[model samples]
Target: MARLPLTILGSVLFVAGCAGEEAPGPGGPGGPPPIVDANGVVPNYACPGSPGCEKAEGPLLVGVAARPITPVLETWDDLDGDGVRGDGEPFDDVNGNGEWDGVWLAGFAAGRAATEIHDDVWSRVLTFEQGDVSVAMVGLDLVGYFQQDVVKVRLEAAARGLDFDHVVVTSTHTHEGPDTMGMWGAEFGTTGYQEEYIQHIVTQTVDALAEAKASQKAARMKVARGEAPELVNDTRLPEVIDQSIHAAQFIDEAGAPFATLAVWGNHPEALGSDNTQLTSDYVHYLREGLEERYPGTTTVFLSGPLGGLMTTIRITGCPDAAGVETCPQGTFERAEYVGKGAADAAIAALEGSGATIEDSPSLAFRRRSFFIQPTNTGLALLVLTGVLHRDVYSRDKKLIPREQQALLSLTNVKEGDVLIGTELNGVHVGPLAIAMVPGEIYPELWMLKPDGSSYIERPEGGDFSDAMPETPIQAVLPAGVTPVIVNNANDALGYILPQTQFDDAPPYAYGEETEPQYGEENSVGYTMGPTLTKEFAAMYGR
Candidate 1:
């Protein structure tokens, strides 16, 4: 594999080769033993070296890229473009198959789009030496909770026996994309591309790693943090004063912007569910915006746990508020909100942090897997209530075909079905950890500290149908670690209610609509990001 000729920005180095092998290459960074060439033979410094040969050189990078994966969610027959399927339904197959197998012709907008199986991917950097760090990134239409699709991660991590915990996976929270978890109680619909799509991710990342290995070089680097006002908001229905600030991380070696890893907590709902074409949601927008500011800079966008923090506030409040304005003193519609506030926060961070291309990071990344069981409270109840609609349209409005059987019919969730707790407080990118969770994280499950939540210290006996963050994640980074929280890094996992509220709310949600409990429960279900965070920080924070 060939490197993309892109400059690599990273911290730390891990020597590669046999387990008990002696140092067969040049001393790293400032280590000596390179100027004096015995026999004028520069050691083969990259890739696989000659058997036991003490001198050889090879490439050091893996590879990376991002693609588009979109799914159709609506048909024309409903006239309103809701999820309903009608006689004049667009994208319907009126043929004698008894099933709408082929796309039926009708009004263009009303037709449900064809199903897709591809996801956009990014970097796959493989480290080839001791003290070396490699990274790759990808963004797909589906969410990544279904670790089943992570077979590629296992294979790649094991390609050289690297730890699976070393690989990081994430998803952008675009409501417009296909369901990552089974929606409407059915697991068959494309959650974008699930476990079956692992090969593509694996292949792309493997190539990326090879390339990164080749592109390795000694370069000066600096990390600067700034806030962008564009990413902020208080879009809650009641219009409370909250923030979802966007923070940009600028990394440059030799005084140039090589990459921008931006962290912000907000739903990637800007691309609206009505869209059927594959896209990276607000990520596409932000990536392009950053690219215009700095060319050749690989922009890896990470999300935060924004369920409770976001307001869906409309831009500039131009459209006024959503929901019942007169009914309450200050109520805002859920959809009228925008994320300009988050972007603004990042702008602020950028302006305040100044710029740094010095003092390389001390990087140490490790990954592992655990069995996660679904609380199933949310899905089970939705199914019983006839809310399970396998063939969902763009707006999430339920559709019914007068003569067709329901795709949402009850079914058993097999071993491979997505079943896991959500990360209660970690922002994620491949191998990167975001420990900061700002906003009112339900105190029910978090172990709050000035540094970060200690999720691993959590008590074991409890049940949640409930929901639940923080502060700047970087401030809490361990003495030797630099941590950043990418808001909404996981999913639109709803609120994390306290334990007292858990028993009261069988299904947790974070809203006034919640029953009389310590915390509220909603249909969206509770999150485990905090739990995952505690475990990860305890295990990986060195």
Candidate 2:
């Protein structure tokens, strides 16, 4: 039997050779030496080798850095075909300074423009390194960035001399920040992606990542999760949600908090559709509250598997401020309450539980690429018109679908399904595992219902009702090792729905008229549900 080649990030690979047992390849003459060159550069992390080879050993250096990414409305397009930016431009006097602020907010599809900066948005960066290997995670305070923009940022990061094995970047999904995804532009179809704004974010993100890498110091890690079921709720499917707030705190040799990475599954939309202020919403307060509680500690919040339409419960009434049903409304005051609550939960988790803080934990990462069919007509049009541009390839790895406007569904570009290069990243630090998915994933797909049965609905070819099984993650991962899902990582291909929950077919409406499951409409296509599940399961060797 031939073993198919599996390459991770095109660096770590398993090649099927003729036979086994050779007279040792590099790394000196010490019994069966691990795969390594003369300089001791083991291409794969899971191989055997020197003191720090194939393992996350001593001087577990970790670093943190951040920089602001708030966009200033510098220019606007000539919407009316006029060369000037004076009359009939998208402007608002949000600050009440008696002048149009010229800024536009991102996230909501309601077309409400930004008026003032309520709070500063930032690009938070974290880097973990052992020996010659390094990997990073960058969290930007904005809606998601398309793969094209992400590639641009990575290229910039590399050009800036920040060399990393892999840099997993994700947006905080803040509805109050600048329009990075281009969906919530001036008008829905029209783009509000300013060249300056995009460049600003790219430059700032790279700078933050570089700074964090430079600041790396000897550290140890503590991973734990706390209950915060009340903080997160699924608007589409209330029963399916990942409410456990996970935190990974890194401490220095001196026992001082270095960096705290917290994760929760919920949309950062505390400032709702009508908001005109540029903010990070609850995410802003989440970081602030954590930093305040643990003085001198930098916190980065990564959104988890929240695609089952996870969002804060609608603030029908102001729970904190009495006598007013909606006194706080979508104000910062409300954001603070939600943010502080989540922060408190994360802090409790860090303090309450005892995590195996490993000074030398095994660190390994694997990244693989796959494709999905894009069935969304609107998104397909955007890709055709160049409004949205990402590298779309054929199954044979050719830059394809050359006839842009000709193919409405890139999924049908070739005889087979057109491949979209979506990546799956798995990183392990001792007993803790982190799965970085390219799109939004429903929690129910990874977690079972309280009744212990798989939470599934509306099956396609296979009936979901007949089920008595574990989730894909649970089935694949080792026992007692809970993998924290970080969705919208690397790329944003819209929502990754469960097969049963996918409602893209006619009768078209996802949720009930009153309860509207908007996530279905936002999905790239129906194939994403099963495709992602299968890919992840196989990637993890299920």
TM-score of each: 0.55, 0.80
Question: Candidate 1 versus the native: TM-score?
Answer: 0.55
**Model 2 ranges off by over 4 Å:** 1-55, 74-103, 315-329, 353-356, 400-417, 449-453, 458-471, 506-516
Compose the digit string of candidate 1's lDDT tens values, residues 386-501: 33212111112112221222332224222223232222233232234445321223322333344554322112222432233322224334444334543322223334333323
Q: How accurate is candidate 1 locally (lDDT)?
A: 0.34
lDDT score, candidate 2: 0.64
Model-by-model lDDT, in order?
A: 0.34, 0.64
Looking at model 2, the pairs that clash are 457-500
Q: lDDT winner among the candidates? A: 2
lDDT of 2 at 148: 48
Error of 1 at 219 (Å): 4.5
* Model 1 spans with C-alpha error above 4 angstroms: 1-64, 67-144, 156-165, 184-220, 228-231, 234-254, 271-278, 314-348, 351-353, 368-433, 436-477, 480-482, 487-542
